[model samples]
Target: MSVRYAIYFAPAKDTPWWDFGAHWLGRDEHDNTALPQPLLDEVSPTELASITQAPQRYGFHATLKAPFRLAAGTDEPGLITGLRTLAQTLKPVALGPMRVATLGNFVALIPHTASADLQALADACVTGLDHFRAPLLAADLQRRRIEQLDERETELLSLYGYPYVLERFRLHLSLSGPVDEAVAQGVTQAVSAHIDRLNTEAPLLLDRLCLFVERNPGTPFQRIIDLRLQA
Candidate 1:
């Protein structure tokens, strides 16, 4: 089986952010537990489950380096060593209060204000760890739907094996997959209400880089370890 790993910013366990996301997604990446999702008035539990299927599989987190297979000459131990070295030079980023927002066709938690520090951290994860990522296979490239992306995105995809990085990256903790236009608004509102109920008003902090692993295709990604930023 081909394993894949990804670098991501996931709020620590025991925190409000972590609890809310885990419950909302109906899975806890930290423990690999299936959680009971919040019940919404307008959306039935079955329908909510259907809509959240995609993000639930990936777990609740914001992608930093994206997922990739280990490159030639690089192993999991080497990747961890590299991340530990990188973590020493990085500092935690404070992303101001977040709100549920629609990005294209999906809903996600997005920061109210942009943070250069967050962008820098994501850029570092993508470029600094490029040596650990194998070149994208033809099947992988096809899966990304290259034809849907613009010129710059195509170039980034070719260079980094994933587009939506560096210049094009937008920090988002996805809540659902592609939502139908008819139900998008309701889903967003429901998520926002759920967040409000949690009352997690403090600014979101990007304090650690979580190493998430998928043992094989079609399997849920799970958190393996969290490397803190010492700087």
Candidate 2:
């Protein structure tokens, strides 16, 4: 059984970047419109299509905490309470603008630069929520180890179910499925064109973090909680 809990921020539709239609059509990659052109010009069409077809599943939000299975005997309500408690101390991060690009074999929107506020928030979530994460299952450890992850990666995964967290974490909004080098070029071009049209002359702002939870495996992740930044 695989269950996950995540923390992410989302922008509202009233913002200049708002486009419910685009977000709905292309998934959350619509948020990637805020990314720089050079990066957008690097993705493949098939990859972009796959990502957009299921955007909410993959696109547009900075992950505060990566997914992890609930520890033995844990329940959802308790987890929710922990999350809310964490939220109380967190002020909203002001990420003025961000870049969109490929994360290894995947496409996503990320900050053109990093922010200290963002880092602090990520750290808080990981540490505060540590008690909820189960230790890595043998299968998870084996699969990640096969990826030749570094010592830090191994350690983090063992502790948090992901190698990247805290200082190593960067924000991203996913845009495509995994693909080969040949397909990557076209996907980049198509997504670049789309992003160009969406991001004209304004900076993109992240206003809120959304808690998207999957009801079950293979089902679409739905918004279970929406946390706004305290002004």
Candidate 3:
């Protein structure tokens, strides 16, 4: 199968955080349903859809292990078993308060303070489950634009089939993809205000490994299951 799988950290469904993100992106990956996006004076409904098109496809979540095909000897069941075993050995990590920020040309919600535990969790997901990941194809490497990456990132990509793993990983819940500079500030402010209105007194917790599947190329990924951390 040409299908690909990814491991991500997504807020539980029906929670305030999940609802807000899903509404903002206008799609709920959990059930593959369209949602009513928040209306902003600065951004029209048409413009909002254009900007969020990319993230909407992937849904609202932070990547733990980037998408990859199963290795020759591995199958979907084996991958699920591995994820379940890994989840049992882990404990939830607290991610302190998050703030709206622009990463490169995109906007995302990122932690105000970096969490070592979060990084470790991501590292474990990437390295521990690597045996099931197939090597990246030439098209995959080209799509990643390895030439644009730094030396260390290039090295990491060669080793892990992804450049932004381990040390290079920046945990974020993307809100927009390559925003237009003209309306970037307005979009940022709008998203910030919306997030501020949310009840964020409690720290966000990384409590489960969400399995997302892309059944075909150019298709939106769907949330398959969440394996809770037992520890």
Candidate 4:
């Protein structure tokens, strides 16, 4: 039997749906749901599913910390307590200007340039959560190699389940599924429209770090913790 585990800041269902529609459109065949038209016009249905499938068919979200398995003896409540303790010392980060771009096969809204505060928050999440992670599995090892992850990246991947962390981490709110080069340009433009609107305002204020978990591989991730950044 598999168990569930993750740490994330889940977007509230009504929080102005953005790029997620493309992913939803791509995934609709498997899990039919409303796709945001504003985004779909930019990419074909085929491309949407393909580009977004790897991360699991879900709506939009900013992954402060990627999900991970629990160590042999760890329990959920203990994990929650640990995260709460960490949140107490940190404050919300002010994201500088951001842009939307296609991250490899996946499409996401990324920082226009780079933001130290954002990197610091990501680092805190990865390091602070280390105590709760389960040991890396063979599959995890294989994935690290496939991604050509560096030492620090491998360490974080082994400890936190995602290769990109800290300085290497780029804040993104995911948009379509994985797509080939053929359709990537259009998807990027569609994503940019939404990103442009947000950029017009002051930099984004990241005040919360949330924990979203899944029971196991096939299940959708859900919110487990909404940790406010401490002052």
TM-score of each: 0.95, 0.75, 0.96, 0.79
lDDT of 3 by residue, 73-176 (tens): 99999999999999998899887577888888988998888878888899999999999999999988998998899999999888888999999999999989
Q: What is the TM-score (0 to 1) of candidate 2?
A: 0.75
Per residue, candidate 1 scores C-alpha lDDT tens digits across 1-231 of: 289999999999978889888888899997789999988886789988998899998899999999899998889999999999999889999875678888889888888887888888989999999999999988888999999999999999999989999999999999889988767788876777656654456557889989999998979998999999999
What would the C-alpha RMSD of candidate 4 be, to one decimal place?
3.8
Q: Write down the RMSD of candidate 2 (Cα, Å).
A: 5.4
Ranked by lDDT, top first = 3, 1, 4, 2
The alpha-carbon lDDT assigned to residue 142 of candidate 3 equals 96
Query: Candidate 2's residue-wise lDDT over 40-123, tens digit each?
Result: 344444444554554546335567777667888787888887777677777876564544477887666666688888788888
**Model 3 error, position 59 (Å):** 0.5
Report the Cα lDDT for residue 151, model 2. Answer: 78
lDDT of 4 by residue, 58-107 (tens): 43567766656787778888888888888897887666466767787766
Q: Whose TM-score is greatest here?
A: 3
Off by over 4 Å in 4: 10-13, 17-39, 56-59, 145-147, 155-161, 201-203
Least well predicted 10-residue stretch by lDDT in candidate 4: 22-31
Cα error, candidate 3, residue 115 (Å): 1.5
Q: In candidate 2, residue 85 scores what lDDT?
A: 69
Which of the two candidates, 1 or 4, achieves a greater TM-score against the reference?
Answer: 1
Candidate 1 positional error at 136, Å: 0.2
Candidate 4 TM-score, true structure as reference: 0.79
Q: Mind sharing the TM-score for model 1?
A: 0.95
